[model samples]
Target: MTASWKNINKPSSPTTAVTAAQVANGPVIPPQQRLLTYSPDEWEGFVEEWAYYCLPAKYKYVQRFSGAGDMGIDIAGFADDKRLKGVWDNYQCKHYDHALRPGDVWVEFGKVIWYSYSGEYAAPRHYYFVAPRGAGTSLSRLLANAAKLREELIANWDKHVKDEITGTQAVPLDATLRAYVDAFDFSIFDAKTALQLVDDHRATPVHTARFGGGLPARPASEKPPQEVAATESRYVTQLLGAYGEHTGSIVTHPSALSVPKLKDHFRRQREAFYEAESLRVFARDSVPPGTFESLLDDIHGGVIDTHDANHADGYEKVCAVTKAARDMQITANALITCTNPKDRDGICHQLANEDRLRWTRS
Candidate 1:
């Protein structure tokens, strides 16, 4: 059993945009909803949803538990194909507003151990700790230490377990339990179903079941919501620029580069280009370079901005920059051997404007 002495709070779900139809129909829910409500229970649901969605198709089905009289296990079930014997697992969810202390994990671990020994269908093959909002540094460190100890025990279980009659080896919960605790998108059971489960599982507070004991104070490093939004906006702008440049260069003619041609080029090569570049840039800068052909395809295919294309002012700027750069490159190549002063002066002015705009936008 993995235990920690941390407050088990929940994450709040954000307000979702409702359509006219949904309003008339009394709120039609989408498949994957963003978590606006932050609570330990809601966070747990988010984790379960993530596991269900991101985990391989094999790990699809999941079961959750909450409420009074329930043992330490908040979720128990299997993933993978139901046809083939599924992998058994259990989950413990914690949503701490404050940083999770080392002792929180210790307590959770003990409860898991007890639940394994005494609860219904107790000892699953695998277990998990699903903290959607995130676990504190202290809790993370303690879990790491517990994992090491669990490994040692598992390696020498025969020697550790005293009773030969039971034919049972010592099983450390940490050795078997996995942690699906991180920040990302997720989708699980419906919000209403999740809320009902939480209400049903509201039982005696388990905050004091400490083994290692006491919450450790730590500085919060979580970013504010506004900062996160700003970061995302900056990232999207860069992505559009890079995408425009790559696509424009690929499609433009040396003599007559047109906007229509640039858009057409993006349509043909967006997917392959995106696939090739997505890993490198999106991972680091959150900017994805889209090809000219791809951008056009997005526009024609209605995949870019569903609203007015004018709303994507950043994309327009990037396109203008890319077109100017391509033209400048062409003119520069054309004037490489020019000896006429009048021609040279005229070409320089044109090049200067292109350079100025390119620099300004980029």
Candidate 2:
């Protein structure tokens, strides 16, 4: 039977007049501006990312609650293990088409008051209404004046908040519930601007992955310490083996590199190895997990064949494989653009450190 699926030639379609709508090119939206366009779920994800960067310093634990039954909490950062029972802060994420106003949040305030009064959780130490477009002028004014905000909440309770908190039942502002509202602290309510959220999110590791911006400037790699630390034991031993095999002598340690050329080569290799290690550290703090590992895997894949090829000695094998790695075209990994020539060579040593690559057959 003919393999029609594998046919080489296909007829091209006749061309027709195309308008701008057909091509549909629009101006690129920067990530900061793009935050306002995220879907409800995506906005919550952004809030989660922001909380990770901004809350860890002050909160012992941070948790997110979603769906219609989350009471008033969207994201909560607990100051202690007691969680809701203990001191905590609330982040009410509002993903609205326009800036949040007082009307948008009266129900939220009522829910917090009702739920906390009923002992579902203690009233949050601080309640922040985080929205992409931020709070409108009237809401900002209300937030600034705590007594007025409380008064507005009470005034709007019957119209906006009486029946809105839960799906099952309408929470009436009875005498007891009214008393709770009267005594509740309204000054805790506030808003976080989009600029503040984005600025804080910039410090997180996933920022570059979420946004297409290039990485922040890398710090200089620390020089390798004078004595070989235990972390370098495996790779350093492998290097000595390669040197011993090349010179046909028992090269026990790095200090045994008596020849000037070999000494310089060893120094450069150590420096490169340090550079690669520094790159690894930088990846841990700058990108998502496994990014540096993927770069290492790419280097290994590019140079493994050269490493297995026959050479005069182990040192020659190291040189060949490292050179291959340096010239490799690694485009897929996120860390590729952030790496240097020395990092490529150092990756080979890192692979050796893991016994993924070896300089000598033995």
Candidate 3:
């Protein structure tokens, strides 16, 4: 049966021919061009998108708020599906480019606890600290400690001891205290699980965000001010400064052989250079008719070859293919010509292997 299936799946012959009817249907979409644009806003948008996607269809009509700054809460809304009665969840999104610190964990957890207690709706039956990136070790430890304290409080209560309430028991934290700590193996609650809880809860189709008090929507004109752009710029500058310092040290101490670090740096540089050159080639080749010729002439006449000599073998091949693609007027960076017949056959086989790729234009 497998042999028959393989025979049936054999690649078709490759021929580059376009009919007027095929052209009229539409120009082929390039893979890179077809890729969805990922803006900074969209980066955090995934938390909401995934939350909504994982949610049961009944819960789909819930109101969604992104970047909601109720202390640490990034998202707040209710899932109004009949199956999940009074189902709602608040999210504390940590868009961290770096590892989360203990302070972040304390702050967010504190917010969840605070909102649960003081907010008009009183307490959400289900609660979560939805950190998309995950929490740091220190933060995880803090959560563990909070969980331990909750356990101790419950244990003491069971034993008919004094009703001394830990800070967590005051309001919001009291309601979610049990689940947050008991649901996970605290020993293993790394940044990954901190983020995974949001999805896991959704998979079970649980709704946690419950509000008793009516909360008015802040108008678009009255939305809270965000300093994200300034913050991002500052972070970038700091990162660039750190990179410059490391690069300076590396240049001064060439004998300091950190093979892995050096290799990673070169690998990233190669990838970036390849992408930039590919984009340049793509833009040059995509110009309307006569303009491409002038662009090509300018590119060919340029001194870019001096840097090409320093490139690795794979990168050299990529450069060669890019130039060939530009000359051939191929608009895709993903399409590469194979010199060896065996390699070409392999490429065809791979392309044919996937059902989705069957209609893809090479």
Q: Which candidate is the best by TM-score?
A: 2
Measured by lDDT, the strongest candidate is 2
What is candidate 2's lDDT per residue for 1-362, written digit by digit as tens? 76786577878764876645345634446776899779978988888778876668898888889987899899898999899999999999999989998999899999999999999999999999999999999999999999999998889998999989998899888999999999999999999998898888888788888875678999999898889888878888888888888999989988988878778888888898999999999999899999999888888899999988899988899999999998998877888768889999998999999999998857
Candidate 1 Cα outliers beyond 4 Å, as residue runs: 1-37, 80-86, 147-362
- Clash tally, candidates in order: 47, 0, 7
Expressed as tens digits, the lDDT of each residue in 37-117 for candidate 1 is: 465675766556544433434455666667764545576556545411335666666665444454444444444444444
Taking all chains together, the TM-score of candidate 3 against the true structure is 0.31
Measured with C-alpha atoms, the lDDT of residue 246 in candidate 1 is 48
Error of 2 at 265 (Å): 0.8
TM-score preference between candidates 2 and 3, better one: 2
lDDT of each: 0.37, 0.89, 0.37
User: lDDT-based ranking, best first?
Assistant: 2, 3, 1
RMSD of 1: 21.9
